[model samples]
Target: MFDLLIQYEWMRNALYAGVIIGFISPLVGVYLVVRRLSLIADALAHVTLSGVAAGLLMQKEVAWFQGVNPLYTGMFFSLAGSMFVEKVRSLYRSYQELAIPILLSGGIGLGVVLISAADGFNVDIAGYLFGSILAVDEGELTLIAGIGILVVLFFLFFYKEMFALSFDEEHAVLTGISRKIINLLFMLVVALVIAASIRVVGILLVSALMTIPVAASLQFTNSFRQTLIWSVVFSQLAVFSGLFAAYYLDWASGGTIVLVSVAILLLILAVKRIVRIFRRNPVS
Candidate 1:
């Protein structure tokens, strides 16, 4: 534990970012799952792949503009892709799901092109594909922390309106809150979180971090606030344990983290079932 962090700079960075991600992800994630927008989060994550690939391909140019850094391009393209998703959602309001497939497919297609062009397809792209607990750097860690703080601030400042919108869009609009603005803001925050998490969890398994905790919380919590708090607890356990396991076993961090979350969720469900059974057969 301490040995790994002491020996590897990357390990330290990954753990730091993972903690921030663990906290913020499930925070906004509860709302997404409640609103049935989990798929949208999944879509935005996939779209970020294009940004990462583009960053790698334009490493030279991006470095020239940003003074020799690849992450700038990655973050830039990610934020742009996120904004694009919002724009697409507005244009295809009647077919909201269409925006996901359109953006997801386009992103992968572009990513493949850029990756092949850069001869980076066969490289150690696992960090971008499945994530690595050893790939995180100081810059990426800072980005995740900054974004995490901003996300919490957004939720804190707009708690009332966000809560209303999450519960019922119609009621929120009826109450004079601009549902459009709130919804767009929610999506934007989701996009930012997903983008910041790409390096830590990758695109494929990012949605798991955003949903598994919510799934677990829903089984035991009826109130929205309770649900959010419990989800954060579950998320923290998943991310921290996964980071520890991935570091020791040298496995894919993204997959490991998500698997850990799922395991916890399953454990919670099992406990629920056993408790119910015991209650029914209390004579023993």
Candidate 2:
């Protein structure tokens, strides 16, 4: 695999794109878990799937769309889906969680129709669903890297506001943070992260990249800042290890990555339980 990295440009592209996603997904994921909107990532990823399917359909039927990239459409629809989520949540304030399932079902329904319209699922769409090393081309690497930078810059400038909002929206508002603008902008950021991530992790499993690292981190940390730092650590570890495994073992890249994440989460859970038992009994 290391030799492949030196020999193949595609290998480098996959590794680069995967690293960026490994970092950005969990970076935004902390806020998602803290805000209790982890499923929002799932909904947005599905909507992005609709967009990707649309792009693929157009690529087959439209001359203009043949020149266009699916990621662009995926990003647009994901952003639109984010706005719709906010709108629906506001409409049903008593049932904000309702937004998730509604968008998810709609996205799946739309994606299926578009995919079927394009003459059934092809290898191209399957790559988006499960991920592929060959799919992480130079263009995708650049696009995802650019979005990753934007996401990092957004948090750098708005970390305090995001932190405040995540911990307590009421307090953030009381502190005179413009809740409306921040909320909208935050949704866009999430949309961008989801769209960028789908290339390497696939739409079906991208939310796991966003969520699993944070879940593992929470097993070991109580501080918000520490949680963010550790989430990045665990995410990077999973991405590198999974990439290596995928390259050498001929496994599905996205599934391998997600399975590594799940293994880390379970290990953390077991360790925490053992620690609790040890603390209760005391070491002889």
Candidate 3:
């Protein structure tokens, strides 16, 4: 099974892309979860799907776009969607959450239209929708690596500010943190993560990678920093195990990865429950 990496360039690219996405997705997810903005990832992912469909359509119909990577177009759309989300959120201060669903619906509608126009890309589109172990290429792996580096640097520079903003937006603002600027930049980062992660986890399941590990980590971790560390640990574990299983069992890579994360979450919940029960009725 392990020999597949040595034999196939696609497998190696998938593994490399998975590792980078596994690390960065949860890193940003921790912040989103803390801020109670998890749904934004889902919205951006849908928007990315539209961009991907558009790219596929253009590639088939226009010679100039034949060599372009759909992932780049997906990134462009995801970023544009993020900015629109922020703008819409500002317009409805009392109903800010409405922004997510609006974009989500619009994204799906546009994606369906574009996909219909493309007409015969079911196989290629399936890879984007559900992730394919063979869909990642050398160029995509490099793009994922670049995105990983950008995410790390963004966190390194803004860690303190993000921490403050996540835990208490009102106080952070009172202390002179620029909520608007920070939020816009954070959304952009999330868009990038979603676009990059789609190749490993697919557009539909990408949010799971971003949120589920963080959810599990919060169960036992006592501090924000510890939670962040454990989230990445759990994510890596899921990616490794999921990829192995996907390879051996011939399952969809995205579904396999998300199910593995879900399994981890369930196991954590069960353990926590048993511990609580034991604490209530100490060994007699």
Q: Which candidate comes out best when scored by lDDT?
A: 3
Error of 1 at 69 (Å): 4.4
RMSD for each model, in Å, please?
Answer: 2.2, 1.3, 1.3
Q: Considering lDDT, where higher is better, how would the candidates rank from best to worst?
A: 3, 2, 1
- What's model 2's TM-score? 0.96
How much is the lDDT of residue 114 in candidate 1? 81
**Candidate 1 vs candidate 2: which has greater lDDT?**
2
How well is each residue in 1-284 modelled by candidate 3, as lDDT tens digits?
A: 57888999888898888889999999999998987889999999999999999998898899999899999999999999999999998999889889899989999999999988877674468889887755788999998999999999999989999999999999999999999998899999999999999888889998999999999999999999999999999999988877887778878888888999999999999999999999999999
Error of 2 at 260 (Å): 0.9
Single out the weakest 10-residue window by summed lDDT for candidate 1.
60-69
TM-score for each predicted model, relative to the true structure = 0.91, 0.96, 0.96
Give the Cα lDDT of each candidate: 0.79, 0.89, 0.91
* lDDT pick, better of 1 and 3: 3
Q: What's the residue-level lDDT of 14 in candidate 3? A: 81
